[model samples]
Target: ILIGEKRFRQQSEDPRTSPSHQPEAGITPSPSPRPRSPDDLEEGEVEEVCEICTPPSDVLVVEGQVVEPFSTDHAQRLIGQIMVLNAQIDRMQEQIDSMRYRLDSMQQEMKNMIDVLGRI
Candidate 1:
C-alpha cells in the first residue's frame, strides 16, 4: 500500500505521467518537421552551422552584399529552396529506412522459408 501510494504520488508529480500529457481533446499534433519555413537550412548544411551561442542583441556583420539591409528577401528565397531540398532529403531518408526494414523482413522470411523447406 505504501509503495502504491508513493508510485501514485510520483506519477502525479510527473507532468509526462498525467492525463494532461495527452493532447487536449481536439488539439492535433503539429505536422512532422516536413514543410519547413524558408529560414531552414538544407539537409547536410545543418551540420556545418557553428553551434556557438550568442546574445540576442548581437549584431551580425556581412562585408560584401550589393544592397543595404543585405537583401534579406534573396536570402529568404535561397533558404526556402534549401528547406524544400532538405524535406526531399528527409523523405529519401525515410525511404531508405523503409527499404532497410523491408530488406530485413525479407531476409528473415527467406530464412524461415528455407528452414521449413529443409524440414520438409
Candidate 2:
C-alpha cells in the first residue's frame, strides 16, 4: 500500500481509531516478540560500509584484526590493565578502612579526656 493513503482503522472494527497495524510503507514488519541480536539491526556487516566495499573510518585493521574503535577498545582491553585497576581499588578500600579506624580511636580518646576533666 502507498504511504499517506489515509486509511482510518480501529481497535476492533470502528473507523475512528487506528489499531496500529504497521506502517503503510514497505518497512518489512519485524516479527512479533522476536528476540533480536545486536547485529541484526545493522545486519552484522562488522564495519560500517560507505560504498559496496568501502569501510568507514571508525574501525581499524591492526595485525590482521578488524577492531571497532568505540565498541572494541574499552570493552576488550587487556586483562593486565584490569588487574592493575582492581588492585588500586583494593588499596583505596584499605586506606579508607584505616582512616575509619583512626577516626574511631581519636573519638574515643576525646571522650576519655572529657570524662577525666569532669572528674577533676
Candidate 3:
C-alpha cells in the first residue's frame, strides 16, 4: 500500500471514536507483526531515485554500510573546524575589501592628477 493511503486510513479512523478503542469491545489480538527490513520498504518510503535510473526502484537499499554513531567529541571537533574555516573566510573577505578600497583611491587620485595636468 502507498504511504498516502496508509496515512489516509489512519486519519479517517479516529481511535477515540472507534469501537476497537472502547474497553467493552474487548482487546482484539493483532496479527504477528514482524520487524521490516530496508528491502521490505515500498517505493514511496524512499523518496530519492537512483542516479542511473529516472524512477526510483522498489528494491532500493537505502543504507548499504552500517555506520558508527557520532559521539559528542566528534561533533565538537567538526564545529571547531567550521569555526576556523569561517574565520579564514572572514579574513580573506576583509583583505579583498581593503584591496578594492585601495584600488578605488588610486583611480580617484590618478583622475585628479590628470585634471590638474589638463589645466597647465
Candidate 4:
C-alpha cells in the first residue's frame, strides 16, 4: 500500500483521542499528522513499475548510487529526522533572538556613553 494510505489505516485503527496516545513528560507530540509525499518514499518500498510508468529519465541517483524504493519504516525514520532538525532549528532561532536583544541593549548603552562624552 502507498505510505499515505498505510498511515490513514493506522490512524483510523488507533485514534489519538485515547489516553494511551497522550504525550509523556519532556516529549512533545506532533500537532497533526501529515500526508507523506512521493519524495518521502525510501529505497526499499518501491514496487516494480512498468517501463512506461518509470522511464530512464525518472530514475533517482544520489552520490553516484541509484536509489531504489524503500518501505514505510524508512519513511518513518526520515520523518523523525525531520522533526529533530525542526526542533534544533527552533532552539537556534531562540538563541539568535536572545543575542539580538543583548546586542541592541549594548548598542543603546554605547549611544548613551557617547552622548555623555559629548556633553562633557
Best candidate, TM-score-wise?
3
Across residues 1-120, which tens digit of lDDT does each residue of candidate 3 receive? 212111112212444445433333222223333435567787667532212211121123567788789999999999999999999999999999999999999999999999999999
Quote each prediction's TM-score: 0.41, 0.38, 0.46, 0.44
Highest-scoring model, lDDT: 4
The residue-by-residue lDDT of candidate 1 on 22-111, one tens digit each, is: 333333322233334335656544322222322222224569857566577989999999999999999999999999999999999999
Candidates' lDDT values, in order?
Answer: 0.56, 0.54, 0.58, 0.60
* Cα error, candidate 4, residue 3 (Å): 56
lDDT of 2 at 106: 100
What would you estimate as the lDDT of candidate 2? 0.54
Identify the runs in model 2 with alpha carbons over 4 angstroms from their true place: 1-76
**Candidate 2 TM-score, C-alpha based:** 0.38
Candidate 4 lDDT by residue in tens digits, 1-120: 333221112222445446554334433222334445556767666643212222232234667667778989899999999999999999999999999999999999999999999999
Worst 10 residues of 4 by lDDT: 3-12
Instruction: lDDT for model 3, please.
Output: 0.58
Which residue pairs come into collision in candidate 2? none
Q: Given candidate 3, what's the lDDT at residue 78? A: 100
For candidate 2, give the lDDT of residue 92: 100
